[model samples]
Target: MADQIDDVDFALAAYRTDGEWVVAELTHDHLEDVDVLSAALRRFPGDTGTLGLVAIDEDFFVIVRVAGTSTRLLLSDVTAADEWELAASVLDFLRLPDPEDDDEPEPAGEVGLLADLGVPAATMAELIDDEDLYPDELLSEVARRIGFGELFDDVVGLTSA
Candidate 1:
């Protein structure tokens, strides 16, 4: 089987309105796939515009076009023959943020807080048993009533536990 990309190894490379590149490492348990990332760029606030995969190192770098600008990122640090380092160097040449930096938070707005919440399996089961409430409606109502962030936290906590 092919080795799966770990969550910590992936970082999001997006562009800012000032033409600067932004690299935010993903901290979630699972890494976002290309399709999901593309969707996120479309939904980002302030008309940042769409994102497209431009180039890949075939080892580490996965360069993308965002809002008509090209941005590259180090997708992993497991260098077999300096490929990861070379990708990082290229990213540096492009003035992107270092993936090693933990100062910046992960990219937001794609997976809503509900997905992150740890709702209990039993609670979910009970909620599902309610014939009057669809799962989507229940989630939406929960999101609306207690705030999406809180709902996500609760769901995440419940599920993870």
Candidate 2:
């Protein structure tokens, strides 16, 4: 069987508009396939459009954003995805091969992809430096920096709320 996403542990779609946050209408099954996930992202409506947040088996998080024909990503721990179907499918979509035995979970793609949107890359590095934070916790920091801390926390159930 093809790699799937419903096997994913936690997934959510959210967008910010005119200073307010809104959770998009997410149909989980339709996005079970990577191609479909990409398609839905591109279809998301707005200027700073929709954002996809997923945490797989508490091992790592995948953030996906699309602008026109270009899609950007932030995969936490490329190695963690190796053992999970959802993470593997995302890695496949990004055209990355599985990691070797000596690999460590590191950020793949442009870490500054959301800098202009307000989540800075340097700040992310500091958070990951601890090496003990889970995918959701790291994402909480992202949401916090981007002005949606409370909202994202409520949706994702972050403890800092």
Candidate 3:
């Protein structure tokens, strides 16, 4: 697992359990910190589930975990523009559902999964204002699309109204 973790850049602490790849935690000194990215890579244990990154430029990174295997691309060489492009590509690749599907789904209501992820209500509201946090319906669609089914499944239990 440790050896597998050493292969990526920008990976910060990963672990595997019951054949599920879990990126336990990650930290970045700055949006573009290389050492932090290196540390992140070193922390990966091996791919079994999925590797997800909430990048600075609205970019999301995904890795398919498999033991002793490199199932994803290295992040070290990606430019900011590329990262955003990759993020969009990944989201599209995963076939995340669109927010506009089915009459917009009532503005996602208030009980959103992002809130469950510990994003402050005020902050989330602000993000929504800026169109950063997708509407609830779209968010759910995206969550399922991004291989966060487990996390999304547990969202109701994790959030507080």
TM-score of each: 0.27, 0.82, 0.32
Cα lDDT of model 2 overall?
Answer: 0.70
The local distance difference test score of each candidate is 0.34, 0.70, 0.34
lDDT of 3: 0.34
lDDT by residue for model 3 (1-161), tens: 22223322342233445665353445333123332333345445543423433323222233222223333322211222232443333334334433332332121223232333344445434443444442332333334444454554344122311
Give candidate 2 misplaced runs (Cα > 4 Å).
Answer: 1-7, 25-27
Tell me the tens digit of each residue's lDDT in model 1 across 34-152.
43444455444323542222222222223233343433222222221132333344334445555543332222112222232344444544443455753334443433332342333
lDDT ranking, high to low: 2, 3, 1
Model 2 per-residue lDDT tens digits across residues 2-41 = 3545455557676766767765535666356556666786
Off by over 4 Å in 3: 1-16, 20-23, 30-39, 47-50, 57-71, 74-147, 150-161
Better of 2 and 3 by TM-score: 2
Which whole-number lDDT from 0 to 100 does residue 13 have in model 3? 33
Candidate 1: Cα lDDT at 129: 45
